[model samples]
Target: MLDQQAVDAEEERLRELATALPDLQRQQYFQQLKRELRDPDTYAALNWCFLAGLHHFYLGQWQRGLFNLLVFMAGLALLFSPWPWWGLLFIVLISVAELWALFRSQIIIQHWNNQIMRRLLQEYSSAE
Candidate 1:
Protein backbone atom coordinates (compact mmCIF):
# COMPACT_ATOMS: atom_id res chain seq x y z
CA MET A 1 0.00 0.00 0.00
CA LEU A 2 2.60 2.54 -1.05
CA ASP A 3 0.74 5.72 -1.73
CA GLN A 4 2.28 8.64 -3.61
CA GLN A 5 2.80 10.63 -0.45
CA ALA A 6 4.74 7.86 1.22
CA VAL A 7 6.93 7.38 -1.83
CA ASP A 8 7.63 11.09 -2.03
CA ALA A 9 8.50 11.27 1.63
CA GLU A 10 10.88 8.37 1.34
CA GLU A 11 12.58 9.93 -1.65
CA GLU A 12 12.99 13.15 0.27
CA ARG A 13 14.54 11.30 3.15
CA LEU A 14 16.94 9.52 0.88
CA ARG A 15 17.91 12.83 -0.68
CA GLU A 16 18.62 14.23 2.74
CA LEU A 17 20.76 11.26 3.58
CA ALA A 18 22.65 11.56 0.35
CA THR A 19 23.45 15.18 1.11
CA ALA A 20 24.63 14.49 4.64
CA LEU A 21 26.66 11.42 3.87
CA PRO A 22 30.24 11.68 2.60
CA ASP A 23 31.27 8.06 2.94
CA LEU A 24 31.41 6.38 -0.45
CA GLN A 25 31.17 2.94 1.09
CA ARG A 26 27.83 3.69 2.74
CA GLN A 27 26.45 5.35 -0.38
CA GLN A 28 27.41 2.37 -2.52
CA TYR A 29 25.70 0.05 -0.08
CA PHE A 30 22.53 2.11 -0.23
CA GLN A 31 22.57 2.05 -4.01
CA GLN A 32 22.98 -1.71 -4.02
CA LEU A 33 20.06 -2.10 -1.67
CA LYS A 34 17.90 0.17 -3.80
CA ARG A 35 18.69 -1.90 -6.90
CA GLU A 36 17.86 -5.07 -5.03
CA LEU A 37 14.62 -3.55 -3.84
CA ARG A 38 13.53 -2.95 -7.44
CA ASP A 39 15.09 -5.81 -9.31
CA PRO A 40 14.10 -5.56 -12.95
CA ASP A 41 14.32 -9.28 -13.65
CA THR A 42 11.87 -10.16 -10.91
CA TYR A 43 9.45 -7.48 -12.02
CA ALA A 44 9.68 -8.61 -15.63
CA ALA A 45 8.78 -12.14 -14.66
CA LEU A 46 5.85 -10.92 -12.60
CA ASN A 47 4.58 -8.79 -15.45
CA TRP A 48 4.84 -11.51 -18.07
CA CYS A 49 4.00 -14.69 -16.16
CA PHE A 50 1.37 -13.57 -13.68
CA LEU A 51 -0.84 -10.47 -13.70
CA ALA A 52 0.06 -8.15 -16.55
CA GLY A 53 0.19 -5.16 -14.24
CA LEU A 54 1.47 -6.78 -11.10
CA HIS A 55 4.97 -5.44 -11.70
CA HIS A 56 3.64 -1.90 -11.99
CA PHE A 57 1.72 -2.28 -8.74
CA TYR A 58 4.81 -3.65 -7.04
CA LEU A 59 6.69 -0.58 -8.16
CA GLY A 60 4.09 1.74 -6.62
CA GLN A 61 2.62 2.57 -9.99
CA TRP A 62 -1.06 2.17 -9.25
CA GLN A 63 -2.25 4.30 -12.16
CA ARG A 64 -0.30 2.20 -14.63
CA GLY A 65 -1.73 -0.95 -13.11
CA LEU A 66 -5.23 0.47 -13.33
CA PHE A 67 -4.80 1.35 -17.00
CA ASN A 68 -3.53 -2.12 -17.86
CA LEU A 69 -6.31 -3.74 -15.86
CA LEU A 70 -8.96 -1.67 -17.66
CA VAL A 71 -7.52 -2.53 -21.05
CA PHE A 72 -7.42 -6.20 -20.16
CA MET A 73 -10.99 -6.11 -18.96
CA ALA A 74 -12.05 -4.44 -22.18
CA GLY A 75 -10.31 -7.18 -24.10
CA LEU A 76 -12.16 -9.76 -22.04
CA ALA A 77 -15.48 -8.03 -22.80
CA LEU A 78 -14.69 -8.17 -26.50
CA LEU A 79 -14.38 -11.92 -26.13
CA PHE A 80 -18.15 -12.01 -25.53
CA SER A 81 -19.22 -9.20 -27.87
CA PRO A 82 -21.85 -9.72 -30.55
CA TRP A 83 -19.41 -9.04 -33.38
CA PRO A 84 -17.18 -12.02 -32.83
CA TRP A 85 -14.88 -11.26 -35.73
CA TRP A 86 -14.23 -7.69 -34.67
CA GLY A 87 -13.83 -8.78 -31.09
CA LEU A 88 -11.31 -11.38 -32.06
CA LEU A 89 -9.33 -8.78 -33.98
CA PHE A 90 -9.38 -6.43 -31.01
CA ILE A 91 -8.23 -9.19 -28.70
CA VAL A 92 -5.41 -10.07 -31.04
CA LEU A 93 -4.24 -6.47 -31.14
CA ILE A 94 -4.37 -6.22 -27.39
CA SER A 95 -2.46 -9.44 -27.02
CA VAL A 96 0.23 -8.17 -29.36
CA ALA A 97 0.49 -4.95 -27.42
CA GLU A 98 0.78 -7.01 -24.26
CA LEU A 99 3.59 -9.02 -25.76
CA TRP A 100 5.41 -5.84 -26.60
CA ALA A 101 5.04 -4.75 -23.02
CA LEU A 102 6.30 -8.07 -21.76
CA PHE A 103 9.45 -7.84 -23.80
CA ARG A 104 10.12 -4.29 -22.64
CA SER A 105 9.12 -4.73 -19.02
CA GLN A 106 12.62 -5.13 -17.67
CA ILE A 107 14.01 -2.15 -19.52
CA ILE A 108 11.02 0.01 -18.62
CA ILE A 109 11.18 -0.69 -14.91
CA GLN A 110 14.93 -0.27 -14.84
CA HIS A 111 14.64 3.07 -16.56
CA TRP A 112 12.01 4.19 -14.08
CA ASN A 113 14.14 3.20 -11.10
CA ASN A 114 17.15 4.92 -12.62
CA GLN A 115 15.16 8.10 -13.05
CA ILE A 116 14.13 8.00 -9.41
CA MET A 117 17.72 7.54 -8.34
CA ARG A 118 18.94 10.37 -10.55
CA ARG A 119 16.24 12.70 -9.28
CA LEU A 120 17.12 11.94 -5.69
CA LEU A 121 20.78 12.60 -6.36
CA GLN A 122 19.96 15.90 -8.05
CA GLU A 123 17.81 16.98 -5.13
CA TYR A 124 20.54 16.05 -2.69
CA SER A 125 23.16 18.02 -4.58
CA SER A 126 20.92 21.06 -4.79
CA ALA A 127 20.18 20.91 -1.07
CA GLU A 128 23.89 21.03 -0.26
Candidate 2:
Protein backbone atom coordinates (compact mmCIF):
# COMPACT_ATOMS: atom_id res chain seq x y z
CA MET A 1 0.00 0.00 0.00
CA LEU A 2 2.98 2.34 -0.01
CA ASP A 3 3.38 4.94 -2.70
CA GLN A 4 6.68 6.20 -4.10
CA GLN A 5 6.19 9.27 -1.91
CA ALA A 6 6.46 7.17 1.22
CA VAL A 7 9.60 5.52 -0.08
CA ASP A 8 11.09 8.89 -0.92
CA ALA A 9 10.26 10.20 2.55
CA GLU A 10 11.94 7.23 4.20
CA GLU A 11 15.01 7.62 2.02
CA GLU A 12 15.22 11.29 2.94
CA ARG A 13 14.98 10.42 6.62
CA LEU A 14 17.77 7.91 6.28
CA ARG A 15 19.89 10.47 4.50
CA GLU A 16 19.30 12.89 7.37
CA LEU A 17 20.50 10.29 9.83
CA ALA A 18 23.58 9.73 7.71
CA THR A 19 24.50 13.37 8.25
CA ALA A 20 25.54 12.55 11.80
CA LEU A 21 28.37 10.36 10.67
CA PRO A 22 31.80 11.68 9.80
CA ASP A 23 32.48 12.19 6.11
CA LEU A 24 34.63 9.08 5.81
CA GLN A 25 32.09 6.97 7.65
CA ARG A 26 29.30 8.39 5.52
CA GLN A 27 31.14 7.43 2.36
CA GLN A 28 31.72 3.92 3.64
CA TYR A 29 28.13 3.69 4.79
CA PHE A 30 26.74 4.56 1.39
CA GLN A 31 29.09 2.11 -0.30
CA GLN A 32 27.84 -0.64 1.94
CA LEU A 33 24.27 0.42 1.41
CA LYS A 34 24.65 0.28 -2.33
CA ARG A 35 26.02 -3.22 -2.11
CA GLU A 36 23.20 -4.46 0.12
CA LEU A 37 20.25 -2.72 -1.46
CA ARG A 38 17.62 -4.85 -3.17
CA ASP A 39 15.99 -4.03 -6.49
CA PRO A 40 12.25 -3.84 -7.11
CA ASP A 41 12.54 -4.66 -10.78
CA THR A 42 14.47 -7.83 -10.07
CA TYR A 43 12.05 -8.81 -7.33
CA ALA A 44 9.09 -8.31 -9.61
CA ALA A 45 10.74 -10.32 -12.34
CA LEU A 46 11.50 -13.19 -10.02
CA ASN A 47 7.95 -13.17 -8.72
CA TRP A 48 6.54 -13.27 -12.20
CA CYS A 49 9.02 -15.71 -13.73
CA PHE A 50 9.31 -18.27 -10.97
CA LEU A 51 6.14 -17.81 -8.95
CA ALA A 52 7.74 -20.36 -6.62
CA GLY A 53 8.84 -17.69 -4.18
CA LEU A 54 12.35 -17.23 -5.54
CA HIS A 55 11.68 -13.55 -5.07
CA HIS A 56 11.61 -14.11 -1.35
CA PHE A 57 14.97 -15.79 -1.57
CA TYR A 58 16.30 -12.84 -3.52
CA LEU A 59 15.38 -10.64 -0.57
CA GLY A 60 17.07 -13.09 1.87
CA GLN A 61 13.81 -14.57 3.12
CA TRP A 62 15.16 -18.07 2.71
CA GLN A 63 12.63 -19.74 4.96
CA ARG A 64 9.66 -18.43 3.02
CA GLY A 65 11.33 -19.21 -0.27
CA LEU A 66 12.02 -22.75 0.85
CA PHE A 67 8.47 -23.14 1.97
CA ASN A 68 7.21 -21.87 -1.34
CA LEU A 69 9.55 -24.13 -3.24
CA LEU A 70 8.47 -27.10 -1.22
CA VAL A 71 4.85 -26.26 -1.70
CA PHE A 72 5.37 -25.87 -5.40
CA MET A 73 7.20 -29.16 -5.68
CA ALA A 74 4.54 -30.89 -3.64
CA GLY A 75 1.86 -29.37 -5.77
CA LEU A 76 3.54 -30.67 -8.88
CA ALA A 77 3.79 -34.12 -7.39
CA LEU A 78 0.16 -34.10 -6.40
CA LEU A 79 -0.88 -32.72 -9.72
CA PHE A 80 0.28 -35.89 -11.42
CA SER A 81 -0.83 -38.24 -8.68
CA PRO A 82 -4.25 -39.75 -8.17
CA TRP A 83 -5.37 -36.83 -6.02
CA PRO A 84 -4.90 -33.96 -8.44
CA TRP A 85 -7.44 -31.88 -6.59
CA TRP A 86 -5.13 -31.42 -3.60
CA GLY A 87 -2.28 -30.41 -5.88
CA LEU A 88 -4.46 -27.94 -7.66
CA LEU A 89 -5.50 -26.45 -4.36
CA PHE A 90 -1.94 -26.04 -3.18
CA ILE A 91 -0.83 -24.50 -6.46
CA VAL A 92 -3.73 -22.09 -6.39
CA LEU A 93 -2.93 -21.00 -2.86
CA ILE A 94 0.73 -20.43 -3.55
CA SER A 95 -0.01 -18.69 -6.82
CA VAL A 96 -2.37 -16.31 -5.06
CA ALA A 97 0.30 -15.39 -2.57
CA GLU A 98 2.95 -14.94 -5.25
CA LEU A 99 0.58 -12.81 -7.27
CA TRP A 100 0.08 -10.59 -4.27
CA ALA A 101 3.84 -10.22 -3.96
CA LEU A 102 4.18 -9.38 -7.63
CA PHE A 103 1.61 -6.64 -7.34
CA ARG A 104 3.21 -5.21 -4.22
CA SER A 105 6.81 -5.81 -5.23
CA GLN A 106 7.66 -2.13 -5.27
CA ILE A 107 6.39 -1.50 -1.76
CA ILE A 108 7.94 -4.68 -0.46
CA ILE A 109 11.35 -3.93 -1.94
CA GLN A 110 11.41 -0.32 -0.76
CA HIS A 111 10.45 -1.32 2.77
CA TRP A 112 13.15 -3.97 2.79
CA ASN A 113 15.73 -1.49 1.57
CA ASN A 114 14.74 0.93 4.30
CA GLN A 115 15.11 -1.76 6.92
CA ILE A 116 18.55 -2.56 5.56
CA MET A 117 19.56 1.07 5.80
CA ARG A 118 18.38 1.32 9.40
CA ARG A 119 20.29 -1.79 10.37
CA LEU A 120 23.46 -0.66 8.66
CA LEU A 121 23.25 2.71 10.39
CA GLN A 122 22.71 1.09 13.77
CA GLU A 123 25.60 -1.24 13.24
CA TYR A 124 27.83 1.62 12.22
CA SER A 125 26.82 3.67 15.26
CA SER A 126 27.41 0.84 17.68
CA ALA A 127 30.86 0.31 16.25
CA GLU A 128 31.81 3.91 17.03
Candidate number with greatest TM-score: 2
Top model number, lDDT: 2
Quantify how close model 2 is to the true structure by its C-alpha RMSD in Å: 1.7
lDDT of 2 by residue, 70-128 (tens): 99989989999999999999999999978988988888898889999999999887877
Clashes of 2: 0
lDDT of 1 by residue, 1-128 (tens): 23445555666776565656557644764675466457768777876775546667878889988777666667677778886666566556656766765776655655566556656566545654
lDDT per prediction?
0.64, 0.91
What candidate 1 gets wrong by more than 4 Å, as runs, is 1-21, 24-37
Give each model's clash number: 0, 0
Collision count of model 1:
0
